[model samples]
Target: MTDQRAPLIQRGIVDLMIAADRLRFQIEAALRPMGINLTQMSLLNHFSWQPDRAQSITELTDVMAINQPGVTKAIAALADRGLVEKIDDAEDARVKRVKITPAGLEALGQARQAAWPPVEAAFGSLDDEELAAFTSHLVKMKASLAIS
Candidate 1:
């Protein structure tokens, strides 16, 4: 018997990849004029989730899809911009963690506002309910990929 599932799986994977690239391009275009790279914005979101706790590079590596070098470079850029600060780990002096500065929070807020106009215009075709459902599936896909 033919493996009918093969075409479905292959097409789904290919479509997802294409969709991801398209969405990333759109987001980058939106974020660019704000003077923030998409990498920096991603780091800011990760850091802001636990503002009090410093997030270690190792922890970020464990959970993030981005490679360590990319994370380091992005963090360095943020540091250079005064948007993030490095904190020494209490247990290990050599290890460092990152926290978003107050300025970083302000930048993040500004960036959020900056990203909206393009996103609103681009996604105008999708109603709120469709957008919500699309987001739900994306979350599920992300979680599934994380385990893989």
Candidate 2:
């Protein structure tokens, strides 16, 4: 007899990957009109949420799950667009801290407003119970994958 477990495992992995890709694509599309990609939007959101805290490139790399060069490039792009400003850390001149500019805040607000409709529509089909359960499952999954 064939092993039933193999197909189940393969299907689960493929489905998960496909679902993630589709969700990412949808989010990217929603952000494209704002002239910002999903990665930059995420960084902007981080800044918006913590306006007072200046984030270092290493901190952002860990938060964004990207490499040093990627974080540096994204920050450089945002700085070039006048959305963010970089300042040298007082304690450690070798480190640079990034802060969002007023223009960045405005753009982030606009992007969030524009992106909400699609997200609302996606969740509109779920009832309150289903939404809660889905959110709980996502939280658990994220925690499970958290780096120790």
Candidate 3:
């Protein structure tokens, strides 16, 4: 006999993907007016958290889960826009570390304001207990995947 649990497992995975996609779309739409996508916003958010800590491209690759070229390109674009800056590492002049500029912090604040409504609306229907459970599940899954 076929495994009865297979369909249940597949449906759960599919439902998670669908929900993630819908949330992403809503966030993207909300951020479009600011001329940034989730990935860029994520980069800004990372930098904003520790404005003084300059992180290398390799570090950013791990955090953003994107390839080096993409990170480099995004950094270049943000640098061009005066949102981020790349400076030579103190110990390693060959390596460049990126940090958020004051403008980036300002943009990040604006982006958060723009993005918060959609995120709040998406979870507004969930009661506190339900939301906490959902978050715990997501955290467990992320840990299982070794995502930082």
Candidate 4:
């Protein structure tokens, strides 16, 4: 029974991965013309969602699921572009926080506008019922995977 289930499990994982990769590829293509990558947009999105419009490096790592070095590098790049600021946390001098600037929000808005139409169209192609099922499944999977 275990041997029989192995191929089924592997195929299921492969199919899921392929679907996800394909969707990501489409999204990347949509965003490429706007000169923004998903990671950068994600950072801006994170700041938009944040109550204070800032996040400590430690909090970024935990919330973004990225390592310190990666977070630091991205934050530095954003800062260099005048999209974000790296500041010492008021509550903790040792903790560095990333804050999105108005420019960042504007850039993020542009990027989102460029990306969302095609991305939404891809989903729009799906039937409403199918989309709902897929969305619910994704939500369940994210929770299962501890994504947030």
lDDT of 3 by residue, 92-124 (tens): 888999999999999999999999998999899
Of 1 and 2, which scores higher on TM-score? 2
| lDDT: worst 10-residue window of model 3 | 1-10
For 1-148, candidate 1 gives per-residue lDDT tens digits of: 2698988988988987887687778778878877788888988887778777788887877766788998899888899999999999999998999889999988998887877776677578999999999889889977787744
- Per-candidate clash tally: 0, 0, 0, 0
Better candidate by lDDT, 1 or 4 = 1
- The full ranking of all candidates by TM-score, starting with the best, is 3, 2, 1, 4
Between candidates 1 and 3, the one scoring higher on TM-score is: 3
Index of the highest-TM-score prediction: 3
lDDT of 4 by residue, 17-118 (tens): 987787777777888886667778888888987525677887888988988898888788788888888887888888887899988888898888877876
Steric clash pairs (candidate 2): none
TM-score, cand. 4: 0.83
Q: TM-score for all predictions?
A: 0.84, 0.86, 0.90, 0.83
Q: Rank the candidates by lDDT, best first.
A: 3, 2, 1, 4
| TM-score of decoy 1 | 0.84
Using lDDT as the measure, the top candidate is 3
